[model samples]
Target: MTTEQHIRHRADGSIDTAFYTSQGRTRRSEAAHSMARGVIGPLVILFSFGTLVALLV
Candidate 1:
């Protein structure tokens, strides 16, 4: 990654949402992964809890 990729804000002081770096994926892919995690993480937890409760009951 280049030094220019470290910018976290726009020139107008708005938060930049496109910021992502390649650990093992490109910036775009990383952003998508983050969004998926945010949406799916809650559902996964809910499903796991439901499964455990069903087993116990």
Candidate 2:
């Protein structure tokens, strides 16, 4: 894979959202995965929690 591809995609051919969505920046990328196992799992949970907190507050 090319360096540019490596920045956007993981080694397993999966799109790495973390790469494009880092440092409070986003790229309008699809931010979903079939299974949340790698770095995304915790982010999903953390963002969920933050959303809940905001709604409840």
Candidate 3:
């Protein structure tokens, strides 16, 4: 995800491997947020497809 895009780079042709925890968000919260963001799109698409099939039937 683009969540790490900001932290994944440095301007001096090196990777930024050092990360500090809980900059207003814990690792758990960040993971849950990422999971929800990932799931919502597919769930919406799947449900909409199901609804369309049901209506057609």
Candidate 4:
């Protein structure tokens, strides 16, 4: 039950966050991209819907 063992035992796969060079980017970059998309996608939709509603009013 040590820290390293606990981290390595996640339900997902390996806990190591190191990125493979074959992928051409680090895991940190991937996580950032995912987070940006998650935030931006909703914001864009909300803005478009609001603009449409405003035009109708």
TM-score of each: 0.52, 0.36, 0.45, 0.54
Per-model C-alpha RMSD: 10.0, 14.6, 10.7, 8.2
* Residue pairs in clash, model 4: none
**Model 2 Cα shift for residue 37 (angstroms):** 2.2
Stretches off by above 4 angstroms in model 4 are: 1-25
Error of 2 at 57 (Å): 0.7
**Model 3: lDDT of residue 20:** 43
lDDT of each: 0.78, 0.68, 0.75, 0.74
Tens-digit lDDT string for candidate 4 (1-57): 656534433356765454434344666689899999999999999999999999999
How do the candidates rank by TM-score, highest first?
Answer: 4, 1, 3, 2
Task: Look at candidate 3 and give me any clashing residue pairs.
Answer: none
Candidate 3 deviant stretches above 4 angstroms: 1-30
lDDT by residue (1-57, candidate 2, tens digit) is 646533467899898878756733532223333343567888999999999999999
In candidate 1, what residue range of length 10 has the lowest lDDT sum? 16-25
C-alpha displacement of 43 in model 3, angstroms? 1.2
Error of 3 at 36 (Å): 0.7
lDDT of 2: 0.68
Task: Tell how far residue 37 is off in model 1, in angstroms.
Answer: 0.9
* Candidate 3 structure quality by residue, lDDT tens digits, 1-57: 445445555678676545343443577888898999899989999999999999999
